[model samples]
Target chain A: MTRAFNFSAGPAALPAEVLQQAAEEMLDWHGAGMGVMEMSHRGREFMSILAQAQADLRELLAVPDNYRILFMQGGALAENAIIPMNLLGQRPDERRTADYVVTGAWSVKSQKEARRYCDVNIAASTEADKFTRLPAQAEWRLSKDPAYVHVCTNETIHGVEYFWTPDLAAAGLPDVPLVADVSSHILSRPLDVSRFGVIYGGAQKNIGPSGLTLVIVRDDLLDRSLPVCPTAFHWKTVAENDSMYNTPPTYAIYIAGLVFQWLKRRGGLAAMEAQNKAKAELLYGYLDNSGFYRTAVAKDCRSRMNVPFFLHDETLNDVFLAGARERGLLQLKGHKSVGGMRASIYNAMPLEGVTALVDYLREFERSHG
Target chain B: MTRAFNFSAGPAALPAEVLQQAAEEMLDWHGAGMGVMEMSHRGREFMSILAQAQADLRELLAVPDNYRILFMQGGALAENAIIPMNLLGQRPDERRTADYVVTGAWSVKSQKEARRYCDVNIAASTEADKFTRLPAQAEWRLSKDPAYVHVCTNETIHGVEYFWTPDLAAAGLPDVPLVADVSSHILSRPLDVSRFGVIYGGAQKNIGPSGLTLVIVRDDLLDRSLPVCPTAFHWKTVAENDSMYNTPPTYAIYIAGLVFQWLKRRGGLAAMEAQNKAKAELLYGYLDNSGFYRTAVAKDCRSRMNVPFFLHDETLNDVFLAGARERGLLQLKGHKSVGGMRASIYNAMPLEGVTALVDYLREFERSHG
Candidate 1:
């Protein structure tokens, strides 16, 4: 079967090896007599799968003993409200406000959703620049005693990313925690888990599939949830139950486990980072050289995972997309908010796929120019 | 590959045909060149899949046009809080109370979760009876001005099913909506959708897989969500966005769509109900006749989907489960809360599987009795 190089953002591509393994084990998982989806969450067979997945993830990210990784649901969107519900109570006597660095569309949504639970202070915002760049940490305004600082390390829609982590201690908010929404670019490289109090992302982009949300939080932060937080979404409750407080997305987690295995075989995140860098450079280099296409985001902060670009001749946009589709380069259409083409080369996207995309880009430019 | 007869409680058995089709389409779906899990939630292919699944479900249950079916996540346990968060505000100015008929473990949990949102009145409870029978409608003492009335129509852990729907209109609470968590027995029989304002279930049992929660709420009930409800969990927002407010569990929905097709091919719920009854009768009939094995739940209210039983000598529980596994009967271990054995013969469990289970039961009884 011919599989296309899918470039859709979030719910994007997964490793061929992972899908192949899943297909083979669909009916009988390790001779367990049933597929992973059919097994009871409490059963020994599924418990093993869950344990392996959690262990592999911890090893891959080098998550410290102080952290608890939660396999949650409702995606990153749901986590927007959940984050505030869990964190706002940390200093209830204080004004119950959190600092937000609004870099792009996702961070904007994040801050807005948090308003439902607590007061939000836009500590820094680059929206004035059309979300084309990340705000410099030096320019961020300090909140006297905010609950936590929130940021979207990677903006899938706006195609901007933070290459460096914010150091709250250096900024004089030593005790204040830093929360990041790393949905699009998680697992692309090694991360200092100690730097952030909480890191969360939707599994669809770089992990496995939609519906399964991964939340990695410092163990100490788990107890700060407000009374209004749903018991199922409570971080402490989920951690205490080992993510089976309710039946987790079993098949999604299993698929994610298969992906973790695939990543490990490929030499983990360091190797994946190298390959991702090469793929991003290959496409970006071609775009930089070609006069026919141009990316709007600032060069230094452009997302290595999601690259949104516009045709030099805006009128040729439809023709460019139609041609890209013909050559098996799919989902080249950009987000409606940003009227241009976007190619999200996530962790699962091989360099060969990016090469094909560059090849198609050159051909389309040569003909259309 | 020899397939076993799996009887898991919630993340239970699925139709073999659906699993086979899913395996075949793992890498590429309908020549789209990417699996369903890999497709964009907004893409034409996945949207068609989402539309068809919703349509098929609407047809299968004869859901009225006023009812909007929502594909959510976090399972029934999460819905426990989400329900009150969305419904408690229906009559905000009033005493802010909701009535609950706690017949079993699930409904008791539901009431406890709701207490976090508003005052919860135990309208009727059979917890005193060990949840072996449904509390009669005549005995219900619902609140005069409740925001809503809640019930667990089928309790998976208790093995009790509500064969009859509770009529709030007949109970002098016409405007107060009746909400039911029909997680385990949702598709096992024909449901009168018009009777309930909200009907929700986790999909793992009879629909497709874990991680997907189905919510069928009448249109009038959507706008009653409290301001504190997470927007992602708001029924109104979800209905307006057609359950696409966030990236949904695409693969799970695709599998559910396949099951819906399988259900339609097998002559819908009516035919499924007949087969389920016959299968339940075969196993329950055997347990009733044999002194060696006895079911704890009342015959009239015993779940056709989940049949919980016990050996006269409780010490043989391990021996019974071991023998059942050796003979390809799986997941017969009952929940720890009510230990013994539970054979969950969901819609996917064929009569032959139940027959095999009965044959094993007879053999075990004769050899040990």
Candidate 2:
């Protein structure tokens, strides 16, 4: 009955209400005599669930009419290759190249994967600064007639985030479409759907669970898939079929729908963003004051969702994690590459969880400082 | 809760016991303080779940040590292209061709998708027979030096099941590996894993849910992926990473693992096969004896998992489904392409459910005939 404040990034925490509702409907969904997982993807009952989920997501994000939202699989990692395959085909006669703004680990992986499908150009990179901040849009080297400009708006591993949408026109790349991997911080705030050509993220972070990926692409971009793109992964085929070209992760979608409903009940993204900001401030504010812990990411571009911080005394890292777990504060261990502690406070994580984490951080520091 | 006998073709019924257990552990799995869906893929808790699921599946199927079981997404449709991409590069100097035995709708789609990556040869096809029967192995005309020979052992749409494995050696294609999409009937019976180089299926029918695809591939064949293969879909990388190269559909995998445990508790595949046989006999026996209903699939090849039948008077089709639903029998409507009724009695469908279905069939016939 005692749930921990789970902070593991991606496949992280989900709303308690969503899980409770799911548990109640596990055997029979809405008296349909079968659980959501057991129902046919094409059945009337599941169709309703699918429709509601899609509609809820659209309303929550205020998705433009010209955009198509696709519930896909293979996570954001698969989309690295899939994105280029879908975009590079738009201009077959032109040079097959795409621009990537590498902020951290995810964008690094994204650009490398796209290299297999097209010539990847790192137009902007914060890797030189150890991915501590987002690269300024003014400093980005524009590519002439590139297929698309890719960016990881939120880097889960490095705890860096883009506070503002990169305007291609401002960067002298007006014609180039901006594609963003917004996996970690998608629903943590309100987004201008019209600002990007395509926005995609795995559902495990701010959404529901892993396995279900949400891709929101402008309708015009749907027809630009390469011949080599798998039929199931092809945006046009999936969009045309209403994401039913393949049997989508039904239960995942249902859970995500439940999450969307929960979000709406909590006053949608604007309210959520406000709470997220408060939670991030509570933790970051404490970290900034404490000499025992130090957050490396720049203040302006620090991810409100994922906060990776290091112990001032590195030797106490193990002790810090062990004590946190004892207090039911879990998954605070940082990514192996980063070698520090990370707290991913996604949409599902309540302020209470953050307060508890901060309390534990202070307690650990009081003893170890 | 008045649970019905759900007969969805895929995304089909799951064991009630598994569903109940999942519900019980929804918010807190094994006192870990977070559900399986909330756990990090690399965390000890979820890793144990992944390991156990893989081990249980390996044990249930008696998969050989040389085989690596991969948990993937994108369903069977995506695997259609992934298969060719992963297999075609074994012989770069030779013609890129793969032989397919198209017996039904799934295999037809499978072969068509493979055409995107390599030359797909229809080695054997029962399309002339309306996929009512499996084409005999002796009749196969496989290509010379094909990367692999593929087959849909059980066609969910056509209700044609292969009672025996196809021996490549007997067909004079000894070295050519055999790949079978056993999606709809995978766990309904004992499988000889050694017979196929790769055995994959969407974990919807005879498994757990939609979204998770299981690929059991022999280790030697894992390294044959083409350069164009997405890293996430590359079987070699997937196998080496233990299917953790991407954030897998964790919750779906957890559910599938629970079903695997349920299967073992139900005395493994041998016991499941016996019950499945009995249930199939009850329904098929009724269909054969009744003049009002007819199953078109060849008697020897009729699937024990999916029984597709038609009303003698086509006008009464709607009435049949309505009555069946009223009697707590659901999803009896056949695929639109086939235009009839299909009762997909997977491993989860008990004999009592089939008996009730038969009772309804008798009542409907007496009332409408």
lDDT of 2 by residue, A281-309 (tens): 99999999999999999999999999999
Deviating ranges (above 4 Å) for candidate 2: none
Q: Per-residue alpha-carbon lDDT of model 1 for B60-106, expressed as tens digits? A: 99999999999999899999999988886756545789999998889
Model 1 alpha-carbon drift over 4 Å, by segment: none
| lDDT for each candidate structure | 0.93, 0.92
Compared with the true structure, what per-residue lDDT tens digits does model 2 show for residues B209-325? 899999999888998888889999999899889898999999999999999999999999999999999999999999999999998998889999999999989999887888888
TM-score for candidate 1, please give it: 0.99
lDDT of model 1 at residue A55? Answer: 97
Candidate that scores best on lDDT: 1
Task: Put down candidate 1 lDDT per residue, A163-230, tens digits, no spaces.
Answer: 99999999999999999999999999999999999999999999999999999999999989889999
**i-RMS values of the candidates, in order?**
1.0, 1.0
Most DockQ-accurate candidate: 2
